[model samples]
Target: MNSLFPILAIVRKDISVWLRQPTSIAATVLPAIAFMVILYFGAQAVGRNPVALVVQDSGPHAQELINILSDSGAFKVTMITIAPQKAEDALRQVKVAAVITIPSNFDAAYNAKKPDPVTIHINNLNLDFTNDLRRSLPAAITKFYADQSAINGNNSPIQIRVKETDLRSQDIDLLRFELVPNLVLLLTTAGIVNAGLATAREWEDSTIKELLLAPISKATIITGKLLSGWITTLLIAAVVLVVGAASGYLRPAGTIYWISTLVIVLLIALASAGLGVAIGAASHRFQRVTAIGIPLSIDLFFLSGGITVAAFLPTWLQTIAHFVPTFYGTHALQMAIFYSSNEGLILDLSVLGATAILAGVLGVLSLRKSMLA
Candidate 1:
């Protein structure tokens, strides 16, 4: 009971100091929020490209094809017109990605069973947009043929059919998929920054000597500091989770999945807090600690597959990611909340648990050395 008093006092002192410094709190939270905002805008720019449509033919067949293109979900028809010149101008001015022009003789060619090609004036600015435009036209044409076949009681010339089977019950959008890594980043930043700041404060204010002279063991001091950071990170993470759930981004299916997600988050926070303490002890300066801790957290986030899936990265990058603790943390959370599956959960938890123990040991050793120095 006597030992617990000192630990609790240390924890309370650190928390009070953290609350008094608003700038420190902002430094801990803003970078992760900024990353999320920037990624959200990037996601918007990648989906549904804008294009122009020019219909020179007034026939039903031409109109049907236009309707098919509009409904394909690949292109946003920003400009629709009868004049080909206008669409060409829009394409030239960069108002649209491509100009699709239905030739005036399209209906005649179709009726006569002759070849008719729709001219597409594409900007070809980049392969991503160009490839999507390239693939979408063919898909639209295929759908048009199928629709015609159904209406005319005739076989469509294109025999290919694609049936998609999803492995999971729900589809996670790019923004929501990105939120997983962002959440991990937030936890990491909170843990490292808060704990690092707390330790560095003692050194910066020349209070380390006083702290060392107190009638408390080094182990208690380390435990108190780590626990303070861990509690702060949990509070921040809870806020983020609540916002995500309220906004309909993170939806854990069952109580078991929620429990698993919380466990992973707790492990990540504890590991990060331990690392933060070590950094703070070694640096012993507020500016230096922030310099190291913030960048280190950001770098870990990228190495842990920041916005992209680790599996889709280059072979060497994926191999490197496997060694990053945040990689397992992100994967564990994603599996728990998004897929609601226990696949690879045990391995992830084992890695996190090992990392937490190793970090705690390092933190204790570093703090002990710093105190003696």
Candidate 2:
């Protein structure tokens, strides 16, 4: 009861001070909105990528394939009537993201009921473009082949049916769906920077001596700071959720989803607040803390695979990502918001739990030493 009183008092006082500073609230909320807007618009602008259509087969079936590619609206099909060697040259010169070739015997194979192969030569320079080609080209082919098969009376020997079972049945916009996990990561960053700065600010203002003279253990003081930071982050997260829902970037799933999200957010807040405390205690100056904290937050977020897909990264980078807490934090948020199931939820929560424990203990120890010195 003795230590608890001071901890609660500190938390309340800190929250009161934080609310009075309007810039702090704006600093936390504005960046999250900006990132969501940038990502949403960037995804929209990536459509209609340029692709080379090298037609060697002058058959009706070949023309049908060409028409399908052009009509899909996924690509800007540049019809290239050059030889295969020149087609390769165009790819090397970066004229297009990929080249789909129709062989000379395309109609002959179709007429004889034999297998016909459409060649796709892609520039592997951009993974995002490559992924687009890999997915869209096959979908176009599937649509065309299905239409052709229906016209031919369904006498085919083998029929493959592709069924996609989506985990989320809600009619949420894809851009909005993709933005949720990213928003979680951004909230974590805000939590860390502001919390870390709060501690550093105390040192810069020479207020540590007052805390040292107080009749309270350093652990209780650190606990107060951590709780204050975590509470502030949750408040910021509420703002983020409200803004995202209002902007149509997020939809409330249900009680379970909100519960799970709140849990993950709490864990992330604890871990990030701990890290911020540690960094602040180590730096002891607001300027040094910001210099180190901002870059550190960006690096951790990148490693977390919040903004970019991690599978396309180098093997070494992926390996490094497994050790970071945000990776699991982002993963947990995705599972809660999009999956609506507890698949791998235990493992994700466990990693974050352990991280919070370790970081919080280390932060307390660091602050203890600083105050005693």
Candidate 3:
């Protein structure tokens, strides 16, 4: 159709514009990286936190456990030979993260092979110590002794080591949760630029009029603008996704799952662009655009559940959340990118696709005023 050329030419010019304007590229890429990088290091430090310990042990095995805990360097072990009353006071005042009490009968329990039960008093919620330190000791020592005994022909598979991961998504720790968030930022920022300003900017600068005056029908001109923004947003998403996958963030959740996620993210960008155009076209001032667009952009991303959970909200917020595309997109992206949640991918795809279509229609309808003019 003679109509299609205007759209194509518009898209071509848009890409060329961005390529020439290096600031545009930096704006989109740098902010997402900053958001992700800041949190990754923070989470790593928090999760691997060191603790302080108060030990009340003097016997050989007690000394051995103390030495092991000390050499492991997970905690700063303090030698507390003080009165039990003093130790209790110190613990109550939060002077230590945890206290280990080895009963005077500890050696009796070890010699009787009944196992010495060391009481662990924890004042903090660091489960790493619970899961790996106190819990791991008996098994580790048993294995160590058993391996030594095996050299003497004891012939017993007496000790076993079991490794467990966080079981969240993709065997990645809470740290890599950054990928989805960074991507969402990428989507939303790009969406606002493409949707809010791209089409409207052209119209404002009289570029749209020139194109319209040239040969493009009003329909093709609008479609081309919408498509241009959509392609730009998606192209960035795809590049980040490829980098994420190669960086071990992509981590094939499932073939279908990944495909659907890709579709939904693109669709969300398109819809967001349409909403941007509708909003931008309605106003002539950048201040009004930011006033209206920035708040909506943030609200949509938050509603998307990229970082927050909808279930935790009061009923009304969650009810309104159903209207948010990022809510569905994030939920779906999580499934496709991390959990490989199969059902999640399909549900997200359908929801996002519907939104994209609706938004595109809105952008097209937004152009009716231009047509009339």
What C-alpha lDDT do the candidate models reach, one value each? 0.86, 0.78, 0.67
Clashing pairs in 2: none
RMSD of 1: 2.2
Most accurate candidate by TM-score: 1
Q: Model 3 compared with the native: what TM-score?
A: 0.71
Candidate order (lDDT):
1, 2, 3
Task: Please say which candidate is ahead in TM-score: 2 or 3.
Answer: 2
Error of 1 at 290 (Å): 2.7
* Alpha-carbon runs more than 4 Å astray in model 2: 1-5, 45-67, 70-73, 76-127, 134-142, 155-181, 215-219, 310-318
Off by over 4 Å in 1: 26-46
Give the higher-lDDT candidate: 1 or 2. 1
What's the true lDDT of residue 78 in model 2?
69
What are the per-residue Cα lDDT tens digits for candidate 3 across 153-268?
Answer: 76544645456876564355555764675577578668766556766676577675687677656777777778877888887887777766766655556677667776767777
Regions more than 4 Å wrong, model 3 = 60-172, 309-317, 370-373
Order of all candidates by TM-score, from best down to worst?
1, 2, 3
